[model samples]
Target: MKCVGLCPAFVVELWGVLEGLCCVRRLGFTKVELNTDSEAVGQLVKEGRVTSLLGNTLAKQRKLLEFDWIIDISHTYCEVNKCVDGLANFL
Candidate 1:
């Protein structure tokens, strides 16, 4: 489920919950409960494409974590490397 939060820890927790739902579905379960806030659910409803609750939850989570840890780290590394290169040129 999508969780609206500025805190990284909360976002990670929400991600884990959504991933767990996928695992359950893969195991042949047809349903899952997404313990999330109203705002998140409202956003999914507004999209008008997510019919099932489970589908909506998974979609929201995927959207939130579109750039997961590896992507974030890679982007950060690239930025830092560019900065270091610029510093080296100046020196």
Candidate 2:
């Protein structure tokens, strides 16, 4: 994990997913299930939609998704994401 300084919450969330994906790839994992508490980011990824602020990053994410691996992106409740919150806080 690394500090990204300050940025919009959406960007931070997207960055987390990107980093998580990269980590999984580096770890030689061929299948992953990525969960996010941010509905906007999840929805955008699921629907393959892009925004001005996230177009490039989202495109990169899409490319990562195209790799020869299975990935599932899901939106979950924040309450169900406490473990991640705890880990983030620890960092």
Candidate 3:
């Protein structure tokens, strides 16, 4: 397993987990993984905050060989209020 992103929250949440140790290292991967282009990991490395091998970018041609999963979400909220005597109540 390999992790390619620099998401601090994800890294922190993953800490102490066996999967956290398989972070991307030097462009080669033993299994499929996830990554992002935010550059957070690179900055961490430059600041001496992190010490680990990084991965190289895969070619465009290689991208077609991989599968991608996408997700979408929608949210809504509702509120109501009632007036009783001189006091206003919310529900």
Candidate 4:
């Protein structure tokens, strides 16, 4: 389910990934490619490190991955990230 909402950047970004995970789980997909413009978030996922602020949510995302799905996530410059391009106009 694609979504957009009024919220801070961090909240929306985090929610996006978490929701994406939920969708993948529901669809019984074993692989996912996630992209984000935030390097900090990319690193967190790649290293399996959850921040205190998002610890619980991150844990849920982790638990959903026990299915051995290939999840590849990377960081790209916001200017080059097309998913967020239209959203930028609202800024």
Best by lDDT: 2
Predicted candidate 4 versus true structure: per-residue lDDT over 17-87, tens digit per residue: 78888888789888788888887777766676777877986787777656678888888787886657667
Return the top candidate by TM-score: 2
Q: Is candidate 3 or candidate 4 better by TM-score?
A: 4
List residue ranges in candidate 1 displaced over 4 A. Answer: 1-7, 36-91
**lDDT of all predictions, in order shown?**
0.44, 0.86, 0.28, 0.75
**Residue 31 Cα positional deviation in candidate 2, in Å, after optimal superposition:** 1.3
Q: Worst lDDT window (10 residues) for model 4?
A: 1-10
Each candidate's number of clashing pairs is 0, 0, 2, 0
TM-score of each: 0.31, 0.86, 0.19, 0.73
- TM-score quality measure for candidate 2: 0.86
lDDT of 1 by residue, 1-91 (tens): 3455565643444454556545655565543434333344334433424445256555665554342221111112324457644653575
Which residue pairs does candidate 2 place in steric collision?
Answer: none
Candidate numbers, best lDDT first, in rank order:
2, 4, 1, 3
Pairs with steric clashes in candidate 1: none
* Candidate 2 residue-wise lDDT, 1-91, digit = tens: 6687789988888888888888999999998999998988888777777788789878888888889999988888878789887887787
Q: After superposition, how far is residue 77 of candidate 3 from its true place, in Å?
A: 34
